[model samples]
Target: METRKLGDSDLEVSAIGFGGWGIGGAPFWSTEGDNASVKAIRKAVDLGINFFDTAPVYGFGHSEELLGKTLKPVRDRVILASKCGLRWSREALGAISKNASRTSIEEEIEASLRRLATDRIDLYMVHWPDVHTPQQETLETLVDIQRKGKIRHIGVSNYSIDQMKEASRYGKFISLQPEYNLLSRSIEAEVVPWCLANGVGIVAYSPLASGVLTGKYDKATRFKDWRSKGVIGTFQGEAYERNIDKVERLKALADSAGRTAGQLAINWVLRQPGVATALVGVKNERQIEENVSAAGWAPAPEIDARLNEVFARE
Candidate 1:
């Protein structure tokens, strides 16, 4: 696997990292058990993936606990990145809103440490922006944590360009996690260019367009109730079906290049500048293997050009 420097920080991570959103047994999605998830994670490590990204909100803290147990033995061998800023209660399964209060952030970090069974997190991030709290207060708290050596580096997820600039004013932000894929190109307007200029690494999530680019779902396919509910279902409706046609066209390009559609999609994101790593969620060992193999193969220039043409038409 190829390794890239994480922005301006000293940390270097694999070009492809494993995301732990689906491993926590959350109510919103069907996921694997602890043993299965751990097996997948271990397989990823064996395949040379050194970066693992998770969050406290995933499975309402269950994801962190699972990650802690599975990766504890090889903690030093990998770069662990987790997030804060989402408020969760015992009765709730998802994050209520963005929160950056001193007490709240501290409590969340302590809990994450306990679950991760680590002395310090390699990359600690604010999962989302808190409209109520000033950025300075939140960033100062992060600075305090850095001084205490609780976190090695700081990052922000889902932050806009102006918000990122404000954050850089407080201290150095080494990374930013955002939703960037063939289906989602909004970040190209400003976020990608800004990160390139300012030297902030981008950890791209949903690089496969939530399985749409994997060539698994078609017009006749029916998703689970969890996928059909709320935003997930609404987003996967007609527009998604239409987008799948574009995916089908791209799959032909992948075939011509002798690569899978998923690999093609991931490589498209990895080819972009300022991308430190692309985070992928896997449910089984085969998925992990397929994703890791993509790193070894690069698409030809013609395939890359064709992919851009297809996306442009979309």
Candidate 2:
């Protein structure tokens, strides 16, 4: 496994990070038992995955707990990242919303510290921007906390270019985690270039297009998980048919390249100029092993040219 620097920050993380959302379980995503999740995480560390990203909202903190249990033994050997600003109830499952206020950020940081069982967080990011709170105030608080040593570095997720610019005024943002993939590339037109100019590392989530680019779904395929059902709404009707058609073609292309569709997708993302890492969700050790195979390998220029042509026409 190779590593890359995160923007201008001193931290260097693995090219491929283990996403904690899937292991979170429950209404969020389809998951196996806690034991399986723990094994997968430990195996990830053994396989040289140094970056692990999670959020408190994932399984209402269960994901962090599991990660903490597995990684605590090798704490100094890994870079831990988690997000805040999305709060929910403990008694019942409800709509989780953003709260980037100073008070809210302070409270969430303490809770995350407790769940993660660590004194300092490597990269602490605002899971999403808060409309009610000003960006200046939120970032100022993050800077103060970083100075106090509760958080090592500050970053933002799901933030627009303007919002990131505003945040830079108050504090340093070394990375931006955005939903970017073959099917969802609107960010490349603006967000990606903006980050590249400002020295912000791109941490691409859902780089598999929520599994659609993995060649596992078809017109008759259906999802039962709430996260999949809600976030994958675009994968229906005409769009669904068109995407499936494109995937079939891409699969043929991948086979010609001696790769799987998922591996090809990951390779495409890593080849992008500003991308520092791609987060791939894993339910078991098999998924981690499969996703990591894309690392340390670069496809020829012609393959990428053909891929760009295939995706641009969509």
Candidate 3:
């Protein structure tokens, strides 16, 4: 496996990282047990996946807990990244409203640390922006954590260009995690360019577009999730179908390159500038193996160009 520098930070991680969402098992498609998730995680680390990204809100802390127990033995060997900004109580799973107070940020970090069973986090990020909380206050909290050695690097996820710039004012943010893939290219217009110019690394999540890029779902297939029940997957029916077609076209390209569509999608994100790694979620060893192989080969220029063309049509 190859490692890349995250922004100007000294931390180097594999080109592909394991997104710990699926392993935590909630609000997503699959719900594997902690033991199964742990097995998959250990396999990933053995195969050279040194970076693992997770959030406290995921599975309402279940995700972090599982990662903590499974990766504790190799805690020092891998770079663990988790986020704050979203608050959750013992009863609920969503954020405690978009209000991120300095106190809340501190409390969340402390709680996450306990769950992850680590003394320090390699990269700590703000999971989402809080419209009610002052950006300065949040950034100040992050700076405080870094100074205390509780966190090595700072990052922001799902932030706009202006928000990222404002956060950068407090200190150097080493990375940014956002929903980015062939189906979700909205970040490319401004966020990506800003990160590249400022030397902020991009950790693209949902690189498979929640499995749409796997070419498994079609017009006949129905998703049983909030996303499908919401506007994007239902109201934009034709758009979804068109995206599927694009995935099929890309699948053909992947076949020629001797890779799966999922692998090609991961490689496409890796080829982009400022992308330190693509956080792919997996339930078993097969998925992990396929994703890791993307790091072994870079797609040809023509294949890359064709992917761009397909996305342009979307």
Candidate 4:
């Protein structure tokens, strides 16, 4: 697999990183079993994927636990990246809230370390923006942690350009993990340009638009989890139909390139400027194999232009 420097940091991760959101066993994502997830994680590493991304809130620590158990033997071989700042109460197990205060971050890091079974994290990130907590305070706490060698580098996820700038005052953000796919281009207008100019690498999550770009669904298709509840635009009624139509055309393009639609979608994101890696969520070994095929593959300029035209259409 291809490797890229994460922002300006010394850490160089694989172009295709394994995203642990699905393996976490969250009801919204659903899952098969721990054994299956374990097999998938091992398969990903064996296939040359050196970057693994997870979060404490993913299954409320379940994801980190699984990742830790599966990768502990190969810990030194992979770049372990996890996030903080999202917390849930014991009383309300599934209900999570953003809490990035100095105390909250300080406490969350300890728990994450314990769950991941590692003394130090290669890259630690603030999972979400907390409105009540100042960016300076949060970044300062991370800086202190990095100073202690508990974390190698600091990054942020789901942050706006202003927040990235504000956090950079306290510590240089090495990376930004955000949702960016063919269907979700909201970040391209500003966040992407700003990151590219400022030397912040982008780790694009949901590059397949939560599977909408895979050409696996149709009007009669319905997901078993909360995704079927229509909370996300791509999973909703009219938008779902529109996206499916686009995926069909995209599949044709993928066919000509001898790749699956999912691989094509991932390749599109990987080819974008400022993208260091594409974090793909996988459950079993087959899924990881399919996703890893996207690495280092770039479509022709004319094909890319046709893809843009498809996105441009209604």
Candidate 5:
């Protein structure tokens, strides 16, 4: 429910933005149904969430369509965000690859517009860094479209400090969307500092450590989805076991504090400096309501410190 300026941009995004990945639901996640997803989005808005972030590859465009139609009536009141760069040869998740090329973006923007049923995207981002393409090409292309009014602001996701440095030389970005949470704080030492110094806001993704921080999984729980494929984040081997150990400690501490693990996780991410918003992917109305509640509250100082110690990786 708390709104903050995204980096240096004038766009006031909610502290808890609606992450559209889960609603898309396919190779990555399962969903109740399209009707449930639509209801979830509306529920988020009713609860004061105004920023919605999605990508073309999310359900291979299903997410955009659902968001486009569901939020059409309240378009002016909310901020719609979508990403390019990560493209797929087919509808399958395995076929997805990074392609931030000029031609690819030009083609992608048009398609996204059509699917989203909007003339301009509030925030357009490169989903991931395309090492093969020059940073200038991607940034300039975004700038060109910015001038043409296709996207209101430019952002980069899953980018490293070095990658951001290279990309910033060409054009300014208002935000950096990185994986930040209790179990994942790699950005704390560098990326967070860089964003604060450069005047870029941090939009954190996977704030719940992909549900591990929600206290629903254990060391024995093996994910059958993309988490097992080593695509992103820590989900296999001894590393996962260590993460689970920390999560267990976090769960106990969060429970004693009279808060759900998910709420605690989201609150911690929002408290971090340089973070403008924390994106929570919801699949139903209940989920959105819970996530939105995390926005206006915080744990006591002692509980917060205990949580930090529980999930500290460094």
Candidate 6:
């Protein structure tokens, strides 16, 4: 496992971070059990994964709680990154919505701190941009909290270049968390360059394309999860079929490279410019082990070129 500096910050985070979405369980993703999930988190720490990313809305607080409880003993050895903005009243998928207003943020931070059981969060991010609230208001509130020593560093997730610039007008954010994988790379054209030019680190989520790049699912295989029809990326219809077709091609290249398709996909993400880390979701120890294998390695030149071509942005 290798470590990289997050943006221009002093924090050095693991290149492969543990994504806490799946461990939350129910309403979105299903986990084996609390015992299994806890073991997986501890296993991740054993394997040198120092960065853990979670959101308050994930399982309506379960993800943060589990992560808090599991990592409390080694809190000083790891970086805890969690998000705000998305809130929920009920533990249901439809109940969640973005609310990054000043008051909402003020409340969200306290709740996150309590749930995470952390005195100060290493990285506090806005899960999504709340169009209803002014960017100035949200960023200013985060700046105030950072000043208060509640949050160490500020960041944003799923934001466009313009939104990031507008938010930066009010406060500084060191990183941008985006849905980036071999299948989804719209950020390469402008966003990556923007981050590189401005010194903002990229934390790419869904590096497995919600499991599509794992080479396990095919055209006939259907998903029963939230990925059945995402508002974000392809997980349905002819577009999904097309993605599957490309993945089928990727599997061959991965075989030629002596790596599983999932590992190859994650390795590709890690090698991309401006990516400080690939936030991989793990439900158990086995899954995290494969994700960890993608790091500290590189594909042969020809295979790397073939991967880029197969998943080339349209």
Question: Which residue pairs in candidate 3 collide?
Answer: none
Better candidate by TM-score, 5 or 6: 6
Kindly list the per-residue Cα lDDT of model 5 for residues 57-138, writing each as its tens digit. Answer: 9999999999999999998999999999998887777899999999999999999999999999999999999999999999
> How close is each model in CA RMSD to the real structure?
1.9, 1.6, 2.0, 1.7, 1.1, 0.9
- The best candidate by TM-score is 6
Best by lDDT: 6
Q: What TM-score against the true fold does each predicted structure earn?
A: 0.94, 0.96, 0.94, 0.95, 0.97, 0.98
Error of 6 at 307 (Å): 0.9
| Models ranked on lDDT | 6, 5, 4, 2, 1, 3
Relative to the true structure, how large is the alpha-carbon lDDT of every model?
Answer: 0.85, 0.87, 0.83, 0.89, 0.90, 0.92
lDDT of 6 by residue, 1-314 (tens): 79999997988999999999989988888889889999999999999999999998788889999999999999999999999899887887778888999999999999999999999999999999999999999999999999999999999999999999999899999999999998889999999999998879999999998788999888898777777747677878899999999999989998998899999999999999999999998888899888899999998999988887888887
lDDT accuracy of residue 219 in candidate 6: 88
> 230-292 in candidate 1: lDDT tens per residue?
543224667877788888998899899888999989988888878889999887888998888
lDDT of 4 by residue, 45-97 (tens): 99999999999878878999999988999999999999989888862334778
Residue runs of model 5 more than 4 Å from their true location after superposition: none
Model 4 CA deviation exceeding 4 Å by range: 90-94, 228-233
Model 2: per-residue lDDT, tens digit, 38-76? 989988998999999999989999999999878999999
lDDT of 3 by residue, 130-157 (tens): 9888889999988988999999999888
Clashes of each: 0, 0, 0, 0, 0, 0
lDDT of 6 at 1: 79
Native-referenced Cα lDDT, model 3: 0.83
Please report, as a residue range, the 10-residue window in candidate 5 with the lowest summed lDDT.
289-298
Question: Which regions of candidate 1 deviate over 4 angstroms?
Answer: 91-95, 225-234
